[model samples]
Target: MKLKQFIAVAFTTLCLGAGTSRAQPVELTFANALSLPQVEPYQRAVDEFNAANPDIKVKMINTPWVEYWQQRRVDTASGKLPDVWLFVPGFGAEWLYGNKLLPLNKYTDADPTINLPDANQTMLKYMTLNGKLYGIGYDFNGQVVYYNPKLFDEAGVAYPKDGWTTDDLATAARTISKKLNGNGRKVWGFAGASAEWVFEGWFRGFNSRMITDDGKYGANNEGGAQTISFFMDMIKDGVMPIPDQKDPNAQAQSLFIGGTAAMALGVGHATYIFSDAGVDFGIARLPVGPAGQVGTGLGGAYVISADTRYPDAAYKFLAYITSGPVLAKVVTTGVPARTSAWGKLSDRMTEFAGKVQGFEPFNAVKGSFQVMDIQKRVLSEVWNGSKDVPAGLAQIATEADAALAKAAAK
Candidate 1:
């Protein structure tokens, strides 16, 4: 329970000066879901900010990820939202449509200290709805392929390079698995490719998409078949595992970390996980699809509530936390939304320098999570050989279209 209860707080000092002393500093409630090591840097930043600004104090409320979001929804309904909180990316449509957030464009535009351009446009795009900015991004994640070079060398397989295509990925995976198998090693060439987020990239590569431009399911066609077929072929070739249905993400990560898998499709923060495992890995941009390279992209941003009584003080803290210097220290998992802060990351994440700039968000559509769930169920059947690609995709499209329509009706 201690892991779930970590909170960041700093004492406020009433400054002694000509007509500057106040009975109480303006207190702002700041909330985030980060726990443990991730929250350490964030606490330090809040303490530093509180010490520097005697007039304003930020009290941090930290909770586990699911509990935090559940609490946020309750707070939003009760009209008692935090003065400022982390605006998770996928919740954009829900929060914005529900009028739970205050548009920060005026604050960002007027503040001379705010570096709007330092934030990645993709992250900003998620925050923006109808041309109005809702928040300032603190950090972001972009997808990439993580490969173990030691496994590659041992298997005598050449390392994957940027701009490699799906065909190229298949070849490399097959070669590595084949060579390692011949050597009596139990390692598979890749893991986690069937993950919904990772699969979205391959969907793009094969000129298929999860949703149409009009926001309906788009994965019910030839291109969708090709993408599904490609993944099925990888499994049939024994290059990748049939994903763990209950939690494919964890399964993929653990397999790679435990050395049973040689490569994985992951996001920017995966460098930390792999590095902690002492794996010498190489990061490559997502492979090129028939159309072009693309993947799942999103991150967290700082947002003020529409109900906040102290917008000015809240904006100050938002700007402070999102500033390059603070983010360079606080953001340990993903790339800082600010490109300027990336230089502070260790060399192991060097592939992230400027590479995330090209990454664009695909899963930002309305009702995306609903559609993603449908894909997971139907695709799991396909991966398990219970359904053919065409039938699986048709089911996905049918079920996802209904879900999207139901969401719209709401």
Candidate 2:
């Protein structure tokens, strides 16, 4: 396809997948915020979808993450939003859902290929309100603890294992930081932000939550704070680094993948940083805390838009990108979302690392995650500095309760 024709089709279908209806030609626009330094894999999937569905055109709009929200807000406010788009479950999901910019409960057909073994109908219950499916898997990611094997050897500490607890992680950090590298310079043993979702994994590691089943915030929230406190104590004791802002890092990825930082509580998709850098990395389940191996967050869901001039066109494009071949391809890039393709994805990822030994650590702890509310309000405030976590969480709970109450009142 010529460049102009490709953009024409993609813009029309918003760059949907292959399973779309060829009989009906539809056009849509897909707005995405995945413009990381690397988007080749995403581009490949888009190209595949465009090739498969020539009639239903899908255009890919890339936005820098830093400025994406600003651009999206303008688009949404001006009613110029694309027909099909990529959205994080937080603000973006809430913005569309709240404004009625999305078509819900329409996409109920089971995508058998959307492989999440632990996922069932009940899990999809809230994804559809008043009986509608608002989203599908654009990309899926899982949370895990990542560490540098080289650091472990330096500390003379036993490396982390599948069933290791938070205390075990803290213990290791304490030991390693206490011992100086050749020149006695202290190296950080573990690090990550105090974000709610990040901490949620920690709390889940300890078996707790910031919210109750009826959409309430938990008592001892800031799972990351508690975890950080323990980690900071290690820092004070020479185990971790005091999270300073002067050059305060925003995330643990750069430090860990750069190999100076020893450990990080991060997502499965983070392997890209390491592989690209030729770093030696390893994974373990979220270190266990008091609750005996907890995990509580899952990411990714795909959805179409009401504004889309070409609705069915987008679905077709969506199918092509998320199905067999492309799905496998996504794995080679980073963490993949589908369960059916796990064998291929695992093999592909392992091979990408030149048959590295520790990639399966994530696969081992895959069973522990639970679905969080698909609400953006709470997630944003908690994860994205909408407010301080404890205060933000409390505020979020109150807001959610009010929203739920209003729904009940209706």
Which RMSD values do the candidates have, in order?
9.6, 11.5
Worst 10-residue lDDT window, candidate 1: 7-16
Please state the error at residue 134 of candidate 2 in Å.
1.8
Q: Write the per-residue lDDT of candidate 2 for residues 176-283, one digit (tens) a residue.
A: 666644485547777764433444545554445544444343434556346435554665565555443322234577777666678876655566656667778787
* Regions more than 4 Å wrong, model 1: 1-24, 154-156, 183-187, 254-260, 352-355
Which window of 10 residues has the lowest lDDT sum in candidate 2? 360-369
Scored by lDDT, the top model is 1
**Full-model lDDT for every candidate:** 0.79, 0.55
Q: Residue 48, candidate 1: how far off, in angstroms? A: 2.8
Cα lDDT, model 2, residue 380: 40
Every model's TM-score: 0.86, 0.64
Clash pairs, model 1 backbone: 205-289, 205-290
Error of 2 at 384 (Å): 22
Measured by TM-score, the strongest candidate is 1
